[model samples]
Target: MSANCSWRSSCGRAVWRSSRSSSCSSRRPGAARPGRTDLASVPNGQAPVLPRTTRLFQGRVHAASITHIKPPSVRAAVPRRPAPEPEPSGAEPPLVATDRLRKTYRSGDLETEALRGVDLAIRQGERVAIMGPSGCGKTTLLNCLSGLEDPTSGTVRIQGTDLYALGDRERTRFRARMMGFVFQSFNLLPVLTAAENVELPLLVTGVRSRSAREQALEALRLVGLSERAEHTPAELSGGEQQRVAIARSLVHDPPIVWADEPTGNLDSENSQDIMALIERLNAETQKTFVIVTHDPDIAGRCHRTIRMASGQVVPEPVTPRAKGRARAAEAKR
Candidate 1:
């Protein structure tokens, strides 16, 4: 061994390691060996330090990191932009609203105005019935309000959101998130089980399959159809299928439910039972309901009746039946 036990700048070790020898193999694999070392100057040599932004040839030369740090003066001179304030949504009612809503259908220039400048507002938690004759555009109004179809003109606002202003995909997502529909036809798939049919909306909204199935069962229980959860739509009766549709609507727990002749296909007994179920749900969930129907008894059950004529909301005529029902409702209140 050499008597000069010099400290190498590369290894920073007092024991000398020759560049060509493998005997001192204590260093990392593939590391570059020290070419040369000075015995006399290493014991007293000062650490090499470059400027703040530049490093020396080897990390051991300075044994310090190189980085750019903003000075306190520069940090103090810069100003941050203020965050914007959110707009107030309290100006309008948090319910369904429409202003001068119009819908015109054109079948090769044979134009038909389905909704003629209709303006109405349905308050939150109100069960509203729209009664009209055939071809009076009651279903059209429901479609436009629920984003199932776009109107030719005017604005429809639901929960302070401009329904038509959103893109097709965004409006679909918003409708799925905010509104539920109970169609005149049960609209249940023939092959899927009751629970599977009810859980479609939850699955569409990206919920887990297990959680969606559990929620679907709970909704079915709410509608008194938990016993038929595994049965197909064909296996159930008409009333039971309608009850499953109601379960599907409530599975999402939407704030608004648009029902288009929900009991149109059922008999009088079934119709009464269905309407009773609807009233119970409305009372329990406090959900806003807009039902389009031709039955006076169903209309009598609502908070108010909106009569339509020729695609327009006409004045609600106070028939003797309506007067008696109104007085009864007042008595209950």
Candidate 2:
């Protein structure tokens, strides 16, 4: 009975040893855990003692990894830019306009009113001839309209902007950009060639030298003087020189061209040539021409004519003599 009892005790000890060995083998490297089948084994002495729940283990892993990961680079937000403004339309309203324009000068005890409430509308693409005898405010009205001199009491608008309110520099810039002038004197620089003389206005308006020369060549060609592009005023004939002056007026492609006595210095043949060139340019380019002249034939050839006498535009009188002359002139033309 004692031998049988000792043998039973030894068998029980062997069973406990086998169960502990099996448990230790299940937790060995690369072996499955008790509740987590997907959990991978770590290196020797580096295995983590994580919580039994999957969520807690994952959360702890994420928290630990965040310390090693760098923060994302931050950048300043940029602002969106606004769109540009639209330009004004519809022919830009004539480039020049006058409303009851008046100009009077007082010298000591003498008083002379050059312009007396002149109401005028000079639109784009229209050729106009202001014809009258001498000393009738043609030059005075031009000066006022060009912003070279302000009216005594009136308003003048250029490119739909008020000119009388502008200061001297602004007025000068406006003139350079929006207007061109020609005169009988052929205001060419004595030292410059024909192309250079034509480019003067572009230089004033800030056109680069290369582009200004190209534009000057084009202006000369438009006036049928491409061959004389290098000639000086002294080298050219009176007609050719006047054409050069006209080209100079057109170099910047100004919207308004005002010519005062453009052909007064030329003979009849030269006058006819200059007038024909002006007419052609007006027809081809649709540029506005406001010519002040004493020549009735030149005025009659224009599309519209305004007769100014004593600072007032005298209406065409409905008389038999005037009617007969008009009919005769029409027949001749």
lDDT of 2: 0.75
What tens-digit string does per-residue lDDT give for candidate 1 at 1-333? 121122344445432223424534555676544433333233343322212222245332222343433322233445878988877766447598899999999999699999999999988878999999999989999999999999999999998899999999999999998999898899999999999999998998899999999999999999999899999999999999999999999898999999999989999999999999999999899998889999988888888888888999999977787788679766965
Mind sharing the TM-score for model 2? 0.67
The prediction achieving the highest lDDT against the true structure is 1
Best model number under TM-score: 1
In angstroms, the error of model 1 at 49 is: 98
Q: Model 1, which residues run further than 4 Å from truth? A: 1-94, 319-333
lDDT of each: 0.82, 0.75
Please give the distance, in angstroms, between residue 1's alpha carbon in candidate 2 and its true position after superposition.
99
- Residue 198 CA displacement from its true place in model 1, Å: 0.7
Kindly give the stretch of ten consecutive residues in candidate 1 with the minimal lDDT sum: 46-55
